[model samples]
Target chain A: MRKTAEQTAEQTPGHDAPRPVRATQMVLRDTPLPPGARWRRFAVKLVALALIWGVLTEFRLDALYFGVPAILLGAALVFVMPVAPGWRISPAGAVNFALWFAVQSVRGAVDVAQRAFSPAMPLRPGFRSYAPDLPGGAPRVMFLNTITLLPGTLSAEVAGDEVIVHMLDTRADLEADLGALEARIAALFGLNVKSRGST
Target chain B: MPDLITFISAALIAAGAVFFIAGTVGLLRFPDTYCRLHALTKADGLGLALIALGIALTASSFGEVFRIALIWFFVAVASATGGHLIATHARRVDRAEGKEGS
Candidate 1:
C-alpha cells in the first residue's frame, strides 16, 4: 500500500508498546533544528561513515570494488541528509552514554543467557514504571528497547515518558541495575528519571 | 555490473537515510499526532530498504552476504507490517478521543 507521507505518520502505535502521546503543545519543542546544527549532524554522520569505509578498505584491497559505491553514497548523503529535517543528534555526552547503553544491553543479555541455562535459575518476574529523562523519540525508543535486551526486563508498556517494564527479579540486583540505568538514561535523555527499586 | 550495483545500492542507502531524517523532522515539525505518525512510517520503510541493500553490497562472501540480505528483508517486512497495524490502532484511538480532526 503506497500510503502518502501524511498517511504514515498519523497512523497508530507500531507495536504492543504504549501509544504515543497525542500531539499536545507540551510535546512540541520550541528548539527546532537550527541550520548550523543540521550541518553539524550531517558532518558527523559523514565522518562516521567515512571512517567505517576506511576500515573496509583496509580489509579489502579491491578499490574498484568498493570505491564507486562508497563515493556515490557519500555524495548522495552529503546533499540529501542535511536538508531532510529530522536528524536530531544528541550531543557528544549523550552519544557516549547511548553507546554505554548498548554495552549494558550486551551485559544484561549475557547474564540472562547464563541464567536461562543454569541449574538453579534465579528468576523473578514483575512489572514496574520509571519516569524518563530523555527528550526526543529515538533516544527513548533506543533506551526502552536496549533495556528489554537486558536479561531480566522487557519494556512491556510506555505511557507518556513513563515506561512500564517486566522483569524476572525485582530484588537488590535489579535495584542496583535500576540505579545505574537511571543515571545512564538521565545522562542521555536529560529527563528527570526516578526509580523506587523497579516499582 | 559491479559499478551499477554499487552506484544503485549507495543511492538507495543515502536516500533511505534522507527519508529517515525527514521523518524525524516531520515528527517534530508537524502540528499534530497523526501527521507526525505519517512522517515516521514513510521514513522507516524506504530508509530500511535502502540501508539493507547498501550493507549487502559491502559483504565479501556471496553466501554470507546473501544470508544477511535475507535477514534485512525479513526485518523490513516485519517492521512494516507492525507500523501498519500500529497506525491503524492509533487512528482509532485518536478518533475515539476526538483526536481525529487534529
Candidate 2:
C-alpha cells in the first residue's frame, strides 16, 4: 500500500525505514571479493588523495624525506583501514555542503569586519524555532551548525530534526533564506520535491 | 615558492577570520531570526574551509595536507546540513505561534 504524503513526512530514518535490509541475504549473497573490492577502492582513493595534496602543497614527489611518508601513510590507511561497505567515499550531502561553505565563508568575513569598525551597529536578538522544508537528520544538523557560524544566530536545540535557532535580528530575512536553502538542498540531493513537507 | 604559498595561505586565513567576525557581528546586530540565520550559515562553511586550507599550507607531508583538506571538506558539508535542519525547525515554530512565514 502506498503511504500518504503526511505519513512519509513524519517518518524518520532508522531500522524501520522503508528500505530495510536483510542481514542473512547479505551474508549469503555471492558477492565476490566484496571485502576486497572495498579495500581496493579505499587504497586507490588515498593514493589519489596524496597526489592532490602534493599539488596543493607544492611538494615534489622526488623529495624523499616528505614524499615517501605521504605515499606510505596513504597506502597504510588504504590497506589497514576498517571501513564498512555502507559508507560512501563522497556522499552527495558533503558535496552540496561544500558549495554552501565556499559561498558563506567569504560572506561571513566581509560582514563581520564591516560591523567591527563601523560607527553604528544595528542589532536584534530573539529566540524562535523553524519547521524547515528539508530532509531530517544530516541536513538538519548542518543547519544548526551553520546557524552558529553566521553573524548573530545560534542553534539552540533540535527535536525530531526540527531546528531551533537564535537570531540577533532579521527573522523574516532568515526565513526567506531558509526557504531558498530548501530549494538549493533539494537540488543537491536530486530530490524532486514539489512542495514543503515532501521530505 | 613555498614562501609565496605561505603568503597566500595567510591571506586566505585572514580573509576567513573576517567572515567569522562578520557572522558573529551580524548575529549580534540582525533584527530578526530569519535574517540572522542568513548571516551565519553562508559564512560558516566558507570561513571554516578557508581557515583549514590556510593551516594545511604548512603540513609536514602530502598525506597530512590531504587529511587537513578533508577536514575542511567535512566542515563545508556540516554547514549545509545544519542550515536545512534549522530552517525546517524554524518553520514549525513559526506555525505554532500563528506567525506568517517567508
Candidate 3:
C-alpha cells in the first residue's frame, strides 16, 4: 500500500512528496457515535440479526431464545468498527440510489456481455486516477464499490482522495461517469460537496 | 395466467443463464486480470440477480420471495466487494513487477 501510494503520488504532477495513503481515511477506526444513535444502531442491527435468524430457522418461534444472545453480541460488534462520522442517509436519496444501481448493474452486465461475445473483442482497457469531491471514509468507499458495479469501470485502488480506476474502454468518458456517480452518492449521504463545477 | 407466469420465469432464468455464460467466457478469454474481473463481476452480479428475480416470481409465498431478494442483495454486495479486492490486488502486483501503465 505504501509503495502504491508513493507511485500514485509520483504519478500526479503536484504531489511531489510521498504521503501515507489512507492515513486519514479510517474505515471502522475512530468515530465516536452518539449514545442515542449508538443504541438505535444496536437495536436495528439486533432486529436485522433476528430476521436472519428467522430466515435460517424457517421462522421458528422457538429459536428466538437461542438467537437472542447471539443477536445482541452481533449488534454490539457493530459499535467496535469504525463508522462514517455523523452519517445520515436520506430515504428518498437511497431509493434513487437503489433504482440507479439496479439499472446500472444491468447496463454493466449487458455491456460486458456484448463485448465478450463480439468477434473483434474491441477492448482498450486502461487506468485513470480520479479525485472525488466527497469527504473521506464511507462515502468514498461506497463510491468505489459502486464504480465496480457500474458499466465499463472498476476502482483498482483508493489512496487518500485519489481513486485509481481501470476502464474497459479508454475512449469512454470515465471521469464524467465518476463525477455523475459521485454527485448521486453525495446527495444520498447528504454531504455538502465543495467545488461542484471543478469535479 | 399460471402458464404466462411460468413462461416469464423461464425466460428470465434463460436470460440469466446467458449472462452467466458470457461472464465465464469473458473470464476465460479476456486479455488481462482487470478486464476479466470486470466481466466476472458485472455478468455474475446481473445473472444472479436475474435468476433471483425468476425464483421470486415463481415463489409460492411472499416470505419466499423476500428470501430470494435477500439472497440476491447479498450476492450483489459480495461480488462488488470481492471484485474491488481482486482488482486492487492485481494492480498492486502489476506495480510491484515494475510493469506500470496497463
Docking class of 3: medium
Over A136-158, each residue of candidate 2 has an lDDT whose tens digit, in order, gives 33344444555565544556545
Candidate 1's displacement at residue A77, Å, is 5.5
**lDDT by residue for model 1 over A32-76, one digit each (tens)?**
666676567656766766555555455465763776567557745
lDDT of 3 by residue, A1-199 (tens): 4578767766753343322334344443446666688778778888889888777778887887888888888999977875655567888889999899989989999999999999898799998888887765678778988999899999887666678889999899886788889989988998778534543
Candidate ranking under DockQ, highest first, comes to 3, 2, 1
How well does each candidate superpose onto the true structure, as a TM-score? 0.44, 0.48, 0.86
Q: How many collisions per candidate?
A: 19, 57, 2
What is candidate 1's TM-score for chain A?
A: 0.56
Tell me the TM-score of chain B in each candidate. Answer: 0.66, 0.86, 0.95
Residue A194 Cα positional deviation in candidate 1, in Å, after optimal superposition = 9.1
Q: Which 10-residue window in model 2 chain B sums to the lowest lDDT?
A: B30-39
Best by DockQ: 3
Off by over 4 Å in 2: A1-97, A150-152, A159-162, A196-199, B1-3, B16-48, B58-60, B70-102
Better of 1 and 3 by DockQ: 3
Candidate 1 residues B1-102, lDDT tens each? 988888888887886676567556655654444334334444444456567768788767766565666676566445534444454455456555675242
Cα deviation of A183 in candidate 2 (Å)? Answer: 1.9
